[model samples]
Target: MADYTTAARPYAKAVFELAQETSQFDSWSGRLQFWAALVSHPDMSERLAAPGLTHQDRATMIEKVVGDEMDEHSRNFIRLLSENNRLPLLPDIAAIYEELRAEAEGEIEATVTSAFELTDSQRDSIIGALSRRLERNVRIVNVVDKDLIGGAIIRAGDLVIDGSLRGRVENMERAVVN
Candidate 1:
């Protein structure tokens, strides 16, 4: 599959700059998310892939569905994507836009996968540790995987810490084999 992030970066940066200039970051975030979800729907994807629809036709269909939710600037953005055949990159654009937004706001989202759900105190402790280590506000998303057996695996951006029992056991097995 093609890597859409490289193509989506320019669009995401442009939109982010516009949002920053206008102090409309939240507004643009919502708009991008809505458009991304719409375009990512299976039905919409199928329709968009169908032949014979002109770029204008595709943009108009999306605009009609979006209705009053989109302002003039947003509609124009959609048109530009349609004209450039970049409509399918909306998801990547939105995701990149969010990452930009988070960076600007000095925040990072982390995910913790564990054998069991974390208690409120445990969650708070993890958040505190990550915040202190990263020197940024941290938000965690918890995922439970029983196969982990114990402990947890924490992922924050490029950093991943695998403290799960399953991971430790695997490492020990590898060491023994070697």
Candidate 2:
């Protein structure tokens, strides 16, 4: 079987393109989030998975769960998924849709782990540096790890800058071993 992400990609791209064309990123994002959550609930998951229920019946039940929040586009999307028996991919579709939206907006999320909690000024400095380095707007997520032993590790997408004392010591150990 193909991976769920692979199967869900085209659907996510379709929804993303539609959302982009209609200038409805926020709307589609919210709708996807809601449907994903609804599909993920254990009780609803069981009902959707029930082999006894026909596709239309399952779709109707799922639509009712969504209530009035679903506009026509949402209703049609759900109906299409139900008819195709692709409803199980809702969560992956939502996540991929968000990633598409984020990429379109030219944003990346970054995280920094340090030996101690970062002060406001310190965080600002890091974001500034990352923005300059990456040449895009940078959002920072800060984490404290006392074991880092007095410095930080920065992760910005594929780029990782390990400046921690622990990291340096590990590198030194590797150098001696080599």
Candidate 3:
């Protein structure tokens, strides 16, 4: 896993730099996202890893699937990966690319798991609080976790703040057990 991540870093950084230079950050992001989605699909992963398929065939498939959604540069990059049998790396590459893009934009992604749906104002409040605490723009990814019981658990990168009733109960249980 570490080796793959290490090998993927350069490609991700190169793609990120090219995207930044071309002023096509959003387009490149969308292209990578599409590629990630495609490559991560179970059937597509099997096809990509199939021993009998030729690189040319894989490249053609990618082009066919993404022709309208991707720019020429993204297509060329995909073709390069196909030639090198690196198509399997697309999902990791996309993830790293997004990480770089977010860092460059002074933004951090936060996962907000709540027992119930959050209103627009509540979402805004969470974002505001996170931004104030982290001193960076916060992009919240909201998820509904019924088991949370009540309130929310927020994760901003490595830092997590658990505010749910389930979490509080767990802490209390631990204290009592100890």
Candidate 4:
């Protein structure tokens, strides 16, 4: 059997494509979140997993909760998942869909950990630098880690820049030992 992510990828891609074509990115995100939350709830999850309930019955239960909140596209998407017994993968599907959406929009989320809190000017400066370096619009989340001693460590997707004093010390120590 395949992992849940493997099961989820196609669904995510389909939803993402539809959302992109229709410019309904936020709406799609909301719809995926609703079904994902519904199916992942403790009570609803047990009911959904009950061997006695037919697939159609489980689907109906979901529709009743979703009612009037979503549009036709979202409703149809949920029905498809139910018929295929893929309801349990909704949360994973939503997450991957969001990642695809963000990638398509050329947005990157970064976290910078510094020894002290950054002023607004400092944060703005870092964002500007990262945007230029990555060539993508950067969204920053700041963190304070005193163990850094000074400077900061930046993490963006697969890229990590370690400018922390502690990191430098470790690198230097390794070089001397080598």
Please report the candidate that would top lDDT against the real structure. Answer: 1
TM-score of each: 0.94, 0.87, 0.81, 0.85
Per-residue lDDT of candidate 3, residues 47-147 (tens digit): 88888888888988888877676667777888888988788888788888999999899999999999998999999999999999999999999999999
Error of 1 at 137 (Å): 0.4
TM-score between candidate 2 and the true structure? 0.87
- The Cα local distance difference test for each model comes to 0.94, 0.90, 0.88, 0.90
Q: Give candidate 3 misplaced runs (Cα > 4 Å).
A: 1-7, 40-47, 64-72
Instruction: Looking at model 1, report the run of 10 residues with the lowest lDDT sum.
Output: 1-10
Give the CA lDDT, 0 to 100, for residue 41 in model 4: 93
How would you encode candidate 2's per-residue C-alpha lDDT over 102-124 as one tens digit per residue? 77898778889999989999989
lDDT assessment of candidate 3: 0.88
**TM-score of candidate 3 on Cα atoms, chains taken together:** 0.81
Q: Which of 2 and 3 is the better model by lDDT? A: 2
Candidate order (TM-score)? 1, 2, 4, 3
lDDT for predicted candidate 4 compared with the true structure = 0.90
Q: Model 4 off-target regions past 4 Å?
A: none
Best by TM-score: 1
Off-target runs (Cα >4 Å) in candidate 1 are: none
Task: Report lDDT (Cα) of residue 141, candidate 1.
Answer: 97
Instruction: Give the per-residue lDDT digits (tens) of candidate 4, residues 1-178.
Output: 2599999999999999999899999989888888789888999999999988887898889888878776778778877998999999999999899888878999988999999998999889989998999998888899999999999999988899999999999999999999
RMSD, every candidate, angstroms: 1.4, 2.3, 2.7, 2.5
